[model samples]
Target: MSDTNENKLYGLVVEFGDSNALVKAAERVRDSGYTHTDAHAPFPVHGLTEALGIRRTILPWIVLGGGLTGCIGGFMLQYWVSVSAYPLNVGGRPLNSWPSFIPVAFECTILLAGLSAMIGMIALNGLPRPHHPVFNAPNFERASGNGFFLVVEADDPQFDLQSTRALLDDLGGAAVSEVYDD
Candidate 1:
């Protein structure tokens, strides 16, 4: 590929067999002044987030927005139905009864929050993509089995190809591959 293509390609990929090795590699990558790096493992590895310096996700904020929207929607729907649309006066109760609306409001709140969480996660993570350059790495298929992989993207301001490779090498990585984009 051309240099432009290579520049668009980010990160070095290092494969490992165990989570311990992956964690150590992550720490080394972080210490190497790389800011755009990721780790993948077949299973959840405790403390991996902290090692990667990953912060708590913003999903909660999205859910909160959804919940607020749902609250307003549910209240409006109920108001229109019971008062403006139908004007039912049952058992001398007020047409816009707040107590009776609680159940529907609560349910709508949860439903919208859940929907927002799913959509937010997918959008934030750029899900449903058909391809990724990392898939081109040899032996990367093992990532879904027992292998762990760490990728430090080249877009990081501190990334220098040779120096990054040497850093990974010194960290005991068995192999490091440059990722490319088309």
Candidate 2:
């Protein structure tokens, strides 16, 4: 890899077998004055978020905003088409009748919220570009099966190459590897 590619990975990889072990390791790493750490597991591990001190995601807020925008847009479109741009008299009904607009507004809200959730999740996860340094590690294919992995990023102020390795070793990690950015 070129120098530019080498600058991407900045961490240490600690391999584990079980969720319990991974959670314990995460807690240890978090308490070790390290802030940039991530964990990978074959399945969602309960309490893992709490262990990593991860805050609630902002996707809900994004969805809410999108839903609100959709509602307003739908209402405005119906209002403009029925009340302002072209008003039609049907069964002596008045223009700007809100009851008839509810269905469109509701559908738009659902559509926008769903779209926002999908897009927000992808955006927040930094998707599309596929390469990851963890893939370079041997036997990492098992990560999607039964393996559990924890990575403590080197950018953390407390991360020292030697000390971090030593810490992982002391934490009963099955294997520890230095992750390069490039």
Candidate 3:
């Protein structure tokens, strides 16, 4: 494909020789004020997240909210049924027994927490991404193996084909190539 206006530009990808080089390139790209960038490596590379300037996620708070909702809902349901709806008196026991409600409320807490964790992770990470534009890069398949790569997304305000390519080259990146949205 040609680099023409007809082609939707995804971004530019640069393959680094090693983790150190990848980290350096990422730091440079971040320092150059490129906000939309990603680093790919076969395995975890220490300090790469910091180099990319990524912040912490709020998934834990989401799960906590879900769990609290479930617990309250479950307890109220049981309360309404036992104390108000039916009010069954078993063996002279008090109708408003709080102890029995604990088990169901606890179970509800666990269930909703687990469900929220799964859903939150999917939503936060933008899952179900069957394909990405970077897959169009040459030799990108190596990214799952030995390849270490950094991509500067065209969405970034500072992203320019010529200058970004030159910057990647200056960072000692090899096989620096443009990735198209196709």
Candidate 4:
């Protein structure tokens, strides 16, 4: 309990043998009211999200707003330039040619939506995070291979070192360890 970063507590990590164990542990953690818990597995584990109780993200709404803005802005830019800024009537065709603007507007909609999705996803996920305390967990690299792990962050209100460790130990996990910020 020295005033140093190395001694800073990050969380408790537990390794499960398989996806089923991981999912069940997540459910138990959620039911026990541990808000800052996370689970990791080598591959996509079905029912993990439901067990974690993670709510849907609002990124789709953000992307939709971007697309709509792009569409309207693209079409308006063309309309203003062609009809008001410098009207050019050629061969009895109206200066305000709406049909010709469709392609560009459609492209803008797609472009903005794609950009929004990419940027929003990255920003929302807290990207560019080169380091995390979970990486300090024992055998954590196996998370991408054969590991299924659960992490209960120390910042959670219900996270007591001894009790959390005991809870994980009692969950039939293969191993349990502490994670440090250093």
Clashing pairs in 4: none
lDDT of 1 at 96: 89
The RMSD of every model to the true structure, in order and in angstroms, is 2.1, 2.3, 1.7, 2.1
User: Which 10 residues in a row give candidate 1 its minimum summed lDDT?
Assistant: 1-10
**Residue 67 displacement in candidate 2 (angstroms):** 0.8
TM-score of each candidate structure, all chains considered together: 0.91, 0.93, 0.91, 0.92
**Model 4 lDDT tens row, 21-65:** 899999999999998999888898999999999888999999999
Model 3, 94-163: lDDT tens digits are 8878898999999999999999999999989898898988889888998998999999999899888899
Cα lDDT of all candidates, in order? 0.83, 0.86, 0.90, 0.90
What is candidate 2's lDDT per residue for 28-131, written digit by digit as tens?
98888788889888888999999998999999999999999999999899999999899999898999888999999999999999999999999998986589
Give the residue spans of candidate 3 off by over 4 A.
Answer: none
lDDT for predicted candidate 4 compared with the true structure: 0.90
